[model samples]
Target: MTVFKVFYQHNKEEVVVREHTQTMYVEAQTEEQVRRYLKDRNYNIEFITKLEGTHLEYEKQSEHFNVEQAE
Candidate 1:
């Protein structure tokens, strides 16, 4: 079985896919069919994994401030 690391642009999430596995597998002969399958299923990567594809990686949207400049 071949393993592929899928990456999402929206949330920057990643997921691993394998043959005959039940992890959002899109099987279609044509590109349109595949697209339709994904769209119909509304499949999305739940969590983003690191480059090693072993652990989940999360990023927080925080603001950084400089205390010295903040008078």
Candidate 2:
């Protein structure tokens, strides 16, 4: 499973807008897979403002988790 957070701007005011949070599990095994998925979905390349890597952790005893940059 791969998760992506796509951010965009909707207006000239420059107010940042979080467009979508997407999670996909694809059989294809490369960056090209995700690229093709985006193209197939007709997601505009211009709308994407920024992308950040997400680090996910899980603990059996805890029900909650957090996302942070992994160094």
Candidate 3:
């Protein structure tokens, strides 16, 4: 599985700005898989980016970083 960083807004119809968005990490096979999982929660997905190498390691260091495995 690869790690993805999902930026989203909860229950909002308007475009989610970067500063106003919430983030989460997901381990999924593809971007579509991540979107499908998050759709259940009805989050307004702003972006999905593959995280790896140095960037992925940097994010992992944050106290708030947590990876949710996508089933």
Candidate 4:
């Protein structure tokens, strides 16, 4: 299976906070798979900016980011 990098954007809102745009990423086989995975987790699919192959070299070229929790 090929490693597909999925980039998507979404919004978050709470009783005391305003909505804002947030970025997300996932490794999947296809775009549809990524969509399904996110949907299953109740994440809305606002926009998909791009999809590309990770080239299986995650160690050499991958950039990591921290996911923050909403309060």
- Residue-level lDDT tens digits of model 4 in 32-66: 76666676453445555333345334422546532
What C-alpha lDDT, on a 0 to 100 scale, does residue 54 get in candidate 3?
A: 100
Clashing pairs in 1: none
Candidate 3: residue 17 Cα off by (Å): 3.8
Q: What does candidate 1's lDDT look like per residue over 7-52, in tens digits?
A: 3333223343433223222223443444443453334543222222
Per-model clash counts, in order, read: 0, 0, 0, 0
Computed on alpha carbons, the lDDT of every model, listed in order, comes to 0.29, 0.34, 0.90, 0.44
lDDT of 2 by residue, 18-46 (tens): 55432332223344444555553534333
Q: What is the lDDT of residue 37 in candidate 1?
A: 38
Worst 10 residues of 4 by lDDT: 9-18
- State TM-scores per candidate: 0.25, 0.29, 0.90, 0.44
